[model samples]
Target: MTLVLDPLSPALLACLDHAYIDGQWLPVTGSERLPVIDPSRETVVAGLTGATGADLDRAVAAARRAFPAFAATSVAQRIAWLERIEALMQERAEALARMLTLEMGAAISHARAAHVPFAIAHVRAAIDVLAAYPFETLRGTTATVREPIGVCGLITPWNWPLYQITAKVAPALAAGCTIVLKPSELSPLNAIMFAQILHDAGLPAGVFNLVNGTGPEIGGAMASHPDIDMISITGSNRAGVLVAQAAAPTVKRVTQELGGKSPNVLLPDADFETVVASGVMTAFRNVGQSCSAPTRMIVPRDRLAQVEALAIAAVAQIRMGDPLDEGTVLGPIANQAQFNRVQEMIEAGIADGARLICGGLGRLEGLSQGFYARPTVFSGVTADMRIAQEEIFGPVLSIMAYDDVDEAVALANDTVYGLGGHVQSRDLEQARAVARRIRTGQVHINHPAWDAHAPFGGYKRSGNGREYGLPGFEDYLETKAIVGFA
Candidate 1:
């Protein structure tokens, strides 16, 4: 179905070709314009011109100019600004959520329920952190101060466009750091709406800027720019590596939230009927685009058949269709390239002798036009298999069986990624014990409610540093010790 934005404001649509710099919308300098496709129908909906190196220079300069004044603002003043941004976001929440569905093909319900609300929670989270944060403390005759880290370059991904944007932007604003944001070119319209929200909220000029372009062009420029104090990116492993390499010469602080092949371990004694169904849904959330999605399901060896049956039942219930449909549970893959990658991974699973319990390569039976992959489940998946080891970033689940608890932990930690993990058990202590043993940045016991306050990042090749809540807020600040202060 062709997606329509007839109800959207003209001003928001006008933001497509313009970059927000120093409180004004200026036409992008680059002549090359990239088409933004509506993944639901595989049609061009809008186009964005890339920001040139010169544009990056101007953005950096504006942020640098604003940093000193912004950084020196009173905590109360910054808090008030954050509150304003939060209120404006709430006022425009529906528009922001709809933009997400149009650009990234997220189900309207999912966009409204998880994407927008979770993003708003980050702003609220920043407000909470800023209210009580102690910027200065005394020790003997010395005073320790946490100050803003000048300017930050933020790069967000397309999978969770607005969610990832606010995850970094809100906290950085709260910490008093000026920003230059390069949102994913693939799904950038929501980001433009976000820029408008910040503008209307009365954010100081240069405090938050949005530039849309390719990773190689805009992202590369931001990383190597000397004026940028820190670079935080949420993207792929390859992209993270390139950013770190580019920023190495500047000696700037670089933080990344990259790829994951996170595992969901089902303790032998756990309620299989309940946990297996929930596990299948968690892995398939967002059409399985989440970096921290638990795509690997590790279960007891003997109950493999039972788990497989439960998984098949859950997959059958997922309703994949038009993202605009309120009842649709799953939407198309966010873009064409990702759709191709997912198909290849599913083919690899079959070729490697993994049992395809349900679903497989190609689009859902009737979804011939859009980028839709069948919700797939594979049994007899060994840890060494490519499907089990790689981050498919689609609705593909790999089920592996373990002989014991030690084996279960080993299976869960087998991959190079340590971004997120899940442990399920009726016994709270046992679940906690297993959670501790899983070598990931965050572990969820029995699929608990998402805590926006918890620090989120990675442990291994998944990338470094944290985002969300206090740690995320502090990541934008630097420490200084004033000796002889007393």
Candidate 2:
């Protein structure tokens, strides 16, 4: 199919073909190129230059060169800069949303409603925190100061492309740290647009840079770069390990928000009619590609039949189709690799004796192309099963039955992951009590609205370091104690 570059302005379309480094739109000199596949259409929307060693080096050098001056900027100046970014993001929100929808598989509504606004919130939140943050505090005769952690290497995932980008970049910028961003090549278009957004926001040259390529080349170089004081990545556990291993040689700080097989424990007293369906919806949100998605639905064994019924009803309501459609609640898997993984996991669930409650391995009826998958729910899932233990990253939910609350808690904490989980109960105190025991970093009681500023990061093999609110802002800072400063 011919690349249709309509609707997007020439300037905006140009971003897809170039890499933004040191505030300049530069071409990738490498022979390798990656096609930006539109999951909605299963076609190449555009192609991006694969970052070569030279490209990574240029970006790192730019950030390193800008670090000293950028770090010296006043807190107020940083706040002002963030405010400008927020404004530009809002102004070009629709364009960015369209790019996100096309390059990724996010529904158009979701792209505008959740993806764009949530990302804008991160920048604003960083500004709010920085405005009141105490950068320096005195302890008797000593003073402790928080300073920018020099040039930061940020690698964000594709599931929530711009959202993850802003989550890391906003705080890093607010902390006065210069940065080089490497967004997932699968959804690199939005990141390119975001780079333009930062550049247009008047971010100083080299303050923010972007490189596009595979993990082995771009990610490895960023993680191992001697000048990159810290490496922050939001990717799979395997990818996180690679980044950590590479950064280990430099002994640089590393923060990762990796994979999760989080559980949604539906208490016995909880209204199954309301909570079960909501849990299914939550698990399947963003097509279940979220690292923190609650893919495991744990319930009292007696209520297994009722939970399965509710889940089927919920899955039935999901409209899987093109991301450009306003009614599409579920879109295609973001890439071919993920689609294959989801298919394999779904087939494995059936092979492992889990009852197929709603969806299974196949495309939705009438959708012959694109990477769409049926919203699947499985009952009679054992805690030890691969589907229950591993991260599916697709719209597949595993329903496990437990005899008692203790068993429920144990079931929820069974996996090595401790990213995010959901606990539903009629009694607030009971829910809170159960929430306290779950080993995950963030727990939702009765599916409360998402806290944009809440601290979000995992506790176990799910990865370390928080990524929201004050903790997120602090992640980009380094602390030093000065004796006799008082």
Candidate 3:
């Protein structure tokens, strides 16, 4: 399982010292350099610096300046722009995939199969939604027109850097809103490449600007800036709160895709072998880094033994190793801090009396280096346990036994987070009934295919506003009622 770090490519290296601003690579205006660490080897592959105050000011101002014309752009023009961006992204998909693997320890296979492809999917979805959207509607004696919200401040997370960027940017562009993006300082190489893609795709100056910095620096600035009309952020609830607070002074709109401890409830009639195994894999996918990952598995108490056996078998199939290797299924945790957090949560689960079924504490066998984590599973997890309730952004699964359907639903909806949930049932009506009760943005029945256009956001503390599809595109728009204009 020992693997050497992939050497930094020259193109990625060249992207380190500068950023894309006003549609060009500009020198960093700040002195502090943030090292981009490869989580697999815990090595600094490259460095990034935050946009200085003046630099952030310039970028925001540029977006503000370009908003008028961009907002006025015809729908056909916006669609064309999206098509071009999608084409460019498709061309560089493999390179971006590699950058993701190197910069954030995503498995090479995952980066190719899930990460890059889904990112491209978002752009394509935006195009399709925009083409058919009704920008103007007549109601009674008034004409309701949807216009661009104006300059946008986008802050994306490291977990799905490119996907999140495209999720925000593509929709913003399709809605005709110009944006300044602050990608995660941790995994920034892909952002660097993405800015280049925008440039190659001929995105107008200031229509899409890139700035790399910490939340307090670039994120705070963008959220607080009066010229930036809306700020969409995807990260932890803590980060989302900070952004919302900062933006409040300006009365700017803030959209967020934050954390989740989503539930996977297996109904009594569900087949334990198939459902448990699939649930284990789903929960552990992306090393459990996904915001909507089903980390909590709720099952019928009578079938706990059967579920545990199947879950153990599922966990055994996972191959944890170097991200670049084709055989590797689970890679290392993306960063040191997250690595430590996962470890802490695993230990807390043990201390909290949750029975550890397999995998616990420390690196994978003989894998002395890197952030490689043990694919862990815990049974007998109670509702109050930290392992069951908190968002452990690692490959850990907590299995809780429920006495009945009501208890199962209650357990699923118990958390403060309502980002995502899953229900398994043989009867479609039963599944639908259970799905309606869970207080989350989206629910999946029988492990359905991912819908790129479904509206995705959370309820409660998981954050606000939706992303994906027409709703995502429209989130960047403002409504205008032209009175008596029908």
Candidate 4:
């Protein structure tokens, strides 16, 4: 199918075939072109050429050139740039949402509601952070100051596409750092549009750059490059380790937001009727692509049957279909590899003796063309089962039963990942106590509202550092102390 680019200007559409380097749309030469497939249709919608090593060199050099002046700009000037970018994003929200739905197979409603809007929130949040951030403070006889951490190399994952880009880019810019962004090649179109938005907002040339390519070519180079002062990545644990290893030679700061097998501890006192269904939907949100998705549902053994019933009913409510369709609550896995992985894990669950309560291996009935999978749930899941231990990254839930609150907390903290956790109970004190015991970076008491200001990162193999709000903005800065200043 020929992907339509309506409403967007001809120049922005042309970004698919090139890289934005040194503030210019330069042809991506001497590299293989990869096809961008629409997961819902299993068809190639567009093709993007990977950036060559030479392209990476030029992009990095450009960011290095722009860093000094950009970093020296007044905080007010940086805030204005972010505000302009946010305004442009708002004006083109519909088009951006359409790109997300088409390229990544996000449901139109989800694209409009979460993907696009939340991305804009990052820019706004950065603006808010930059407006009042104290760059310098006096402590006793010493004057300590925070300064931009030079040029940044940002690598974002395909699952959250636009959201991850803004999460990194906005804060870097707000901190007065120039950037070279390497967005996932699987969803390059939206990143191109974002480059156009930044361009139209009149951001200085080279302050922001884009290069589309595989992680090895662009991301590896960025991680190792001496000119890039810092590197941040939101991707798989394997990828994060590789980046960290490559960056070790340079001694550059490397921050990563990696994998997770987060747990949802549903305490016995909680409202099972209310929390169970919400837990099911939250685990399956974004088709379970979120790194922090609570796929492991921990419940009291006595209440397992009730939780299973609610989970099965919740799965029944999911409408898996064309992502463009308004009624599609669940879409296909983002790519074929993820689809295959999900199927293999589900098979492992069956072989390992976890009881299949609803849905199962293979595509959902009536949807054989796309990369779709059944919204599956497995009961009687032990903590050691592959379905419970692994990150499925699909619309699959593992309901593990626990005998007591201590065991429940143990199950919640069982994973090698410590990215996110969830606790549900009617007794606020009990829930708070349980939340403290879970060894994760962030814990939710009762599905609290998404807070842009909250620090987000992992604790163990889940990776290091945080993103969003003040912590996120501060990550792009360096500290200096003038000890003699009084």
Candidate 5:
């Protein structure tokens, strides 16, 4: 199927005038530029105004100036503003969804349903959390207060642009903290649109700012800036480390949600045909770009062949082509580099003695122009294989057979990164029992609907901090004990 470019709404397009800094959209000191790409067709979608070190300084200074007043805003006032933003988001949901679909390569159906609805839910969740949060509590003579942390440097990734942005922004606003957002250069169109929603919602100028640029220039500047009190980032672990190193000198808070190599352990008694197929489907979803995708499937040795067969059948069913096709399950890898990376990993797996049960290299026939990758599956893989230890971040699944549940747990926890995991079993008690042994931050007994109210983070080198629920709101706040008798 040929790709169809989704047009952006006029109002959404108007937000690109300039970065919101110092109470207005100020032009940048540098004329560097970045272009958004539609990976499904390898086409340039939109051009975003890029920033320099000087441009970042301007945005940070504005955030610093607005901090005191913004942080002093009453909870009631913040709620009202959030309400307005929520309304605007719903009114413009289709346009925003189209932008997300085009820029991030999500199907329009998913963008409209999953992405947009989830973003709106995040907005509502923040308002709800703020309304009920125990911001002020008594610790005997000392009254504890959760105060806004100050100007926040929010850096989000390209995978789930709108979702990650709201996961940070909604909470930061709820905490009465101002922010300067540096969304991923690859998918900046919708983020720019979301910023406009806040602007049109009557938010005070300078309360929320956005600068578009690569990580080294804008993101590095924001993290190292002395005046910024906290930095919250959602991206790769490499990016997390860089942000932390940058924030160390200033002694500011650094919170990150990084990469993952999650596991999906299918118990012996579980229906291998059903669970294994579902596992393959989950790993292939979103073209397997999700941080928490169950890319590694662990099955009992006795059932290894059974699971592999099911996985192979599922991978064969994936339609790798245009994302716009309602029938297409596997879209192109996000870019040419990702395509090359997945191909290299496939070659590595084959070289390292892992058996290729299904796909191994190159694009699907007749669609070589795009960054398309065939849904890949490998079996006879040892947990220590490079593919199992590392994150391929593509629609590739590596199946490893285990002797017992203990071995499964050990293999799952062997990774340095622990972001998410999956436990599939026929018995509810057995699934719960397995979930306890997993070391990841969030685990799914099965493929459960994402709870808007759950905490999401990672352990080990996967980075720190949580997003969603009350815990997610806390990332943008600091604790203060105001001791006194009123």
Candidate 6:
């Protein structure tokens, strides 16, 4: 029987589905293991059997063997398999949601609607895009055929869990590529559950593999492996750089969706109360662990006081507690290190002379055991301040005032990260213009629906690569031009 984790806690629960290697689930040899922490309760959920060099070798070997058959699958069949994954994930949404909550401290509601749906939606969208995708195009006497690259190494982060995995895996599978998945140890439970859905859907063994471990051992191995045709990673800028470096020698394609210090620009004419409030709440949503979270809010200088007032009032409403608690809008940081990191950044913000508007440092009252952080907001923050420049990965908002739209755009583009940005505007044209000016991979205009058919990635240090939609499918394929073929 396929192992699937259900009774979630951070103890040695023997991974429900250990790393899948050589078409079978297996454990590491020695000196390799990862402790999955329940971020909300600051306790061990499970000890994941980490991937070893031998495990990586086995997975890579399996993928190589499965590649010829899997890649030769007809486009129609690939699309059908992707569709199967979508339906199966939808059928098992509740279980996936529950596993995600226990694994990563994501709110149950968010996990259900955002996490689970995101994964399913991306897979289905890939199927849809594949239907319309120009697999073989003719130009004059020449024909161009886009074929699968080969066996792939996929590394996903913990924040969004399955959402990121599907974004990579779905499109690659749709393009007829085999893959090995390296999910974050912090959120391994969800990956296992997702894999079970795939297995149940009858995905051929070796077509997909899952190896859980730290970045140094398994991640590095996957990146540098010669048998692996390409590698995709979604993580921090530091991690992205490391992956790229490892893959450089092998000359393998390395695509990354990394960190972001995204900006939220509240127009001068925009309703200050509603915009700032919503922006802050969204920023702190998921305890501000999102890579696309607009941690910095750029407002007009004259409206600084008004914006600050609304932001403080808004963030105050988010209830922080257990991830399973329906009342809790914000849970603890993913772990102790993250909590400490946020605390240190909050202190740095204070030291830099930024005024604390509300919710300062330390754990929430009555819940001192978990990794809870008092949702923090810093006002009177300058552009050069650490809080405004760095990706804190917490529910801390930095308020920065700008003289005009030009200044706001500049401030928004100042950071090395260009993953995502949010803009509130009354005029569509103006928002579009501002969106173009921002150098981010994605710009959300007026809380637009996250269409899974759109390309999502970063422009700069946020990392290079796009996932989702047609562009995402293209990443998994290589085009070959045949002369006089048409």
Model 1 CA deviation exceeding 4 Å by range: 1-8
Candidate 2 residue pairs in clash (backbone atoms < 3 Å)? none
| Off by more than 4 A, model 4 | 1-10
Worst ten in a row by lDDT for model 6: 8-17
Q: What are the models' TM-scores?
A: 0.98, 0.98, 0.97, 0.98, 0.95, 0.97
Could you tell me the TM-score of candidate 4? Answer: 0.98
**Which of the predicted structures, 2 or 3, would earn the higher lDDT when compared with the native?**
2
* lDDT, model 5, position 86: 94
Candidate 5 TM-score over all chains jointly: 0.95
Model 5 lDDT tens row, 125-177: 99999999888888678888889999999999988889889989999999999
Q: Can you write out model 1's per-residue Cα lDDT over 411-485, one digit (the tens) per residue?
A: 999999999999999999999999999999999999999999999999999999999999999899999999999
Per-model root-mean-square deviation over C-alphas: 2.4, 2.4, 3.2, 2.1, 3.2, 1.9
Report the error of model 4 at residue 333, Å: 1.1
Clashing pairs in 1: none
Clashes of 2: 0
lDDT of each: 0.92, 0.90, 0.89, 0.91, 0.85, 0.85
Tens-place lDDT per residue, model 2, 360-412, is: 98887899999998899999999878999999999999999999999999999
Q: Write the per-residue lDDT of candidate 6 for residues 349-374, one digit (tens) a residue.
A: 99999999888888888886888889
Instruction: State the local distance difference test value for candidate 6.
Output: 0.85
User: Which residue runs of candidate 3 sit more than 4 Å off their true CA positions?
Assistant: 1-9
